[model samples]
Target: MSLELKDVEKKVGIDTHIHSTNLKLEKNTINILLGSTLAGKTTLMQIMAGLDKPTTGEIWFNGENVTGKEVQKRNCSMVYQQFINYPNFTVFENIASPLKITGVKSDEIKERVGKVAELLKLSAMLNKKPDELSGGQQQRTALARALVKDSDLILLDEPLANLDFKLREELREELPKLFEDRDCIVVYATTEPQDALMIGGNTATLLEGKVIQYGKTLDVYNKPENLTSARVFSDPPMNIAEINKNGETFKINNNNVQWKSNLKIKDGKYKIGIRPHNITTYKEGNNSVEINGKVLISELSGSESLIHFTNGKLNWVSLSNGIQSKNIGEETKLYMNIDEFLYFDQNNRLVNHG
Candidate 1:
C-alpha cells in the first residue's frame, strides 16, 4: 500500500518546529529517509507510523485518511536501532509474538515464523534467547518479526547503526531483498550515504525538522537544492569557497580564476562548491591558480587516500585513488576543479547555470 504525508507539521512547544512537510512513498519500494543525527528523520517516521500525532496536517494510506489511527491499528511494523526482543522468549517465540497477539492459529504462526527465520538465517537460533545470539543475529530476529507480521508498511530506524562493519555490509545487501515481490512499502532512515545509495530508491533529505530536498536518489545527489543540502549528502563534504564576479572574470582574493560559464553578478559575495573527488592535484602548472601548502596529514584506505593540505590560512582535503604521498612537511601545488564548481549566492542558494 502507498503512504502519503500531507502538510504534516509537528511541534514540541512554542517554537514552530518541524514545519508542514509533504512526502509520498510508492508501494513495495524502499524509500530511504537520508539524514544525520537530530535531523528529524526519526520524528517523521514516528508520525508516519502512527506512534506520534502531528500537531497539524494529515496522513493518508491507500487514498484513505488514517491520520488518527493508532500504532497497532495501522498495518505497520517498526524496527528500531536497538533490537527490542523479549529476553525470556526464544527467537521463534519472539518472531511469532505479533502473530499470536493478532490471534493467528498456532500452526500458521509456526510456519510463518520458521519461514522468516530461515530467510534471515535465524533458523538455527530459533531455540536461543536474545542474549544467546550475536548482534547481527538479534537484528535479524527483529527483522524477521517485522516481516512475519505481513505489515503493509515497514519503518526502519538506523537498524544497522550498532553492528560491526562486516555484519553491516552483509545485512545491507540482504535487507532490501527481504521486501522484494512483497506489497510492502519500506521506509528506512539512515545516516550512511552508502546505505542510501545501495538501497537506491526515492530519497527525502531532512535537516533541522525540515524536508529540504526530495526526489530520485541520483538527481538529489547530483543537484542539491541549497548549500546545506549539498553538504548533507557529500562525504568529505562539498568544498565551499568565496568568489567575486568582477566584470567578465571571477576573482578570488585578488587572483583571477577562470570562469567555466558567464555568471551574472547581482550580489557582492558568492560561494563556490566542488566535490573532493572532482579536485585534481598537479605538480606544476602556470595557468592553474597555484596554492602552496604543506601536507598536514595523509590517510590511506586501501584503494583511496585522503590528504589534508594546509596552506597557512587555508586547509582543504583532496581525494585520490591508488596514490600515496610521503611528503608531510613538503609544499605541494593544489589545483581547483573549475569545471565541476558549483556557484551559490550569499544566501547559500545555488546559482542557476542555465
Candidate 2:
C-alpha cells in the first residue's frame, strides 16, 4: 500500500515541467500536499493515480512498477473537486458502482456499500438520486464509492471545495477517521493551510510544480526552509522588514531592535520575519520596538479580535482576546516579540542562529 515516486520528471516538449520530483509515502497515513493554485498538486496526484503518465520517471506501488498503467488497472480511487456521481443513479448505486465493476457478488456489494454508507453518514440518503441530494451528501457519496472499491491508494483533489463552511469543517474532522485501520495510503491535496493543520500528519509543500519541503506538519511550520515556504502557512503571512546592523544591535526604523544572537554581521542587508500572533501590543514598554500609528481597522471574531495598525508607510497586525478598543483615528503604540523573529540573508535564505 506504500507509494513512491523516484526521480519523477514530467515535461511538455521543449518545456520542462516538473523537474526531478521525489516523494516517498508510507502506508496507511494521510500525506497532505499543500500549495497554491497551479502548483502542480493535481498533476502529481494524477501521475501517481495512473491517470497521467510521467514524462521520464517511474511509479512504484507495493514493490511493483506501475508506470504507464491505465487508470482502471491501478488499484487507486480518486475523489475530485467536481462530484463525479451520476445524476440518474441513486446514492446506493453510486457507492456500489465500483464494487459491481470489479464483479463483486450482489450480497457482498450490498454489505460493502452499507458499511461505507454508514461510515460517511449517508445511510439515510442511499435511496435518493444524486440530483435529489445536497452538495455535501453528493461528496460523501463520491467518497463512499471510493471506499467500496477497497483501493490501495486514495487521491483527493480539493474534495471539500463545493461544501459550505460548516459542512467542510465537519467533514474535515470526519474524513481522517475513515482511513484508520485501512491498508491504503491517502494523498489529500489542498490549497488551504488550515486543512493541513486540521489533518495533522506528514505534509509536503509544493511550489511551482516542485516539492520544496516535506516533513512532519509541525516541523515544517516551525522551521520553514525559506521565505516562500514560510509565507505559505502563515495567516496574515509573515511580516518581513529590512534591518540594519548598528554595531552589535540591529536597527529597524532607526530604533535599536534587540536580537537574541551574538553572531557577527557584516551585513549588506537582512530581513526579519514575524508572525502576526507572535506580536503583542503595549501602551508603553522599556525594551520594545515602539512605534506610533493610527488604527486602520479592527476586526472582531467573537472570541478574538485582530487589529491592524498603520504607522506612516509601515503596517502591522496584532492579535488579542476579549479586548475591545475604538481607536481608528487615534495614535497607538505597538510591541513585537523580538525573541520569535526569523532572520534571512540577502539571498532570502533562512539564517539559523544556534
Candidate 3:
C-alpha cells in the first residue's frame, strides 16, 4: 500500500497554506514531517488524511484517487498534540469506541482493546476515566485508540508535544517499537528536529509552506539540501555567516577570521552553515579555528552549557558538552571545525563540498 500526493496544493482564497507538494509513502514505513510551527506540516497532513481537500492535484491511496473522499469513509487514524480523549468514558470504552462504530463483535473488541492497552502499558487503568489519568496516560489512551483501529494510514500530529519531558522521551523511544509489527503507513509530524532523528524514518523538512528536503532522516540531517532545511532541522538554530572564498582559503565577511579550506566548490561568495553543537568552548582537533566573541547569554541545560554569544554583528550559539559557566558580557572564545561547514550558494542551495 502507498499514499501519494501529486502536485497537491492547499490555498485559502489567495493565501497558500501548503505549497505544491508531491510525496509517496510506502506501507509499513514511518514518515516524519519535520518543520517549525506554521510550516504547513498540519495542512499537508490534513490533506493526506482526507480532513482537508487539496485545492490542486490528487491524493492517491494504493493507486486509487482519494482526494475528495470523506475522512469517515477512509480507514485512517489520527492522534493530535492534545490528549483528545473522551473525558466521560473509561479507558477501555475510549479505545473500544472506534471498533464499536465499525460494528466489531463485543468479544473481539474486548480482546483487541485488551491487547492494545497492555502494549501501551494501560492495561491496569482500563476502568479509569480520562479525568483520573495523568497527561501521559491520557495521550497513550489516545494513541491506543489509533493503534487498535488497524488503519491503513496513521497520522500523528505532534502527538507528544503536550507531554512532560520524561513522558515525551519515554514514548518517543517506545513509538517505533509499537509500530514495528504494524502493517500500515505511519506519518508523524513534529517541529523538534531531535524527535525526527530519534524516530528513525524518512523525513520531509518543511520551511514556510514548502517542503525543503525529503530523505532518510539522518541523511537529510547530515546533508540538508539547502540552508532552509538546515535551519529547520537545527534545534538551537544553525549559525550562518557570509564569507568570500579565494582559492583554498575563505575569510568571514565583516570579520578578520580567515581559514584555509578544502571545500570543492567555486571560489566566490557563499554562506556557511554551522550546527551549534560543533561550536564549543574548547578545541576538538588540530584544525579547530578559534574566534572570540562576547557572551550575550549563558545557561546550563543538564550537562551542556549553552553559550549564546555575539561575534561582530552575528549572534551565534555554542552547545558545549559538560558544564562551562560564563557570565553575560564576558569575553569567550569559540572553536569551530572548518571541515563541518556547509557551504550554500547565493540562492541558498547547499554547495557540495565533495
Candidate 4:
C-alpha cells in the first residue's frame, strides 16, 4: 500500500541523474514530479518502476526491499508521453494485452477490459485500430491498458505532453477524477507548472537531479520552502531581484527603486520574488509599489497579456488580466501589491512575514 525510496541515487558513468532522493507515497494518492527538461523526472520514474536500479539506495514496497527486482516481477504500469499502442490490434485487444500475458481467464479478461475501456470513454471505439483513433483516443487507449492491469504502482511520464492543447486540457481535468477511487499510487511527471496545479496532488519540485521541496500541491505552490522550489513551481519562472533591507524599507540593488516592507527582519541583503500575476498595468490595491520599465516583449495569450520588461538592471514579467499591449522599448509602468512579494534570505530560504 506504500512505496518508499530511501536515500536513492542514480549515477551513469559519473553523471548523477538522481541525487539522494528519499520519498514515500501512499496508496490512492497522486504525486507529481514537477521540473524542466533534463531535470531527472524520467530517471526518477524509471527507478521507481524498477526499470532502472538506483546506484546507492534501497526501494521498499509494503516493507519489502525491491531495489534489485526485475521490472517483470513487479506489478506496476507506466504510460509515456508518446501514445504507444499496437497499431495492428484493436483497442480492446491493446487494453487486454497485459492481462492476456499473465494468462487471465477469457471471462475475466473481457470483464476487466470492458470496465477499463468504459472508464476511459473508449468503449464505443473498442473495435477500431490505433491508426484510426484520434491522438487523445490513442493516449487513452494506452492509459486504459495500464489501468486494466490493476497495477499497484502507476507511473505516468508526461502522458499528455504530445496531445493538442484542447485534448491535453480535457485529459488534465479528467485525470484527478479517474484516480479518485483507485487503490494504486500514481506518480505523474510534467514540466509545465499549470498542469501540476490542475492535477491537484502532492508535488515534488525537482531541479537538475535534486528534489528541492515536496508537499501538498497548493501548500507547496503558495509557500515554497525555498527560492529554487518557487522558481520551479512558477510557469514563467518567478522574477527575482536582489535588495538591501534597512530597518523599515528595502531598496532594489543598483537602482533608485525603493519600497517600504512591513516585514521584521535584520538589516542585510535579501532577494524578493514576484509572481507574474501580482503585477498589473494599473494600481490594484491601496498599498502598492510602482515600477517603470522598458518593454521588452508583449505576448497576447487569449484574454491575458504577458509583458516582459526591464526595470533598472533586472528583467521582470507582468501578467495583466486583459488585453494590454505596448511596443518594444516603450516605457511602461506596472503596479505590484506589496503583500504578494516573497522575501527570501541570503541563503535562499523563504522568510515568513510576521
Model 2 RMSD in angstroms? 3.0
Q: lDDT (0-100) at residue 98 of candidate 4?
A: 93
lDDT of 4 by residue, 131-159 (tens): 99999999999999989998999999999
lDDT of 2 by residue, 76-117 (tens): 899989888978889999998887888999999899899989
Q: What TM-score quantifies how close candidate 4 is to the native fold?
A: 0.97
Ranking by TM-score: 3, 4, 1, 2
- Clash pairs, candidate 3, are none
RMSD of 4: 1.3
Best by TM-score: 3
lDDT of each structure? 0.82, 0.81, 0.93, 0.93
The TM-scores, one per candidate, come to 0.89, 0.89, 0.98, 0.97
Candidate 4 lDDT score at position 120: 92
lDDT value, residue 207 of candidate 2 = 81
Q: Which ten residues in a row have the lowest lDDT in candidate 3?
A: 345-354
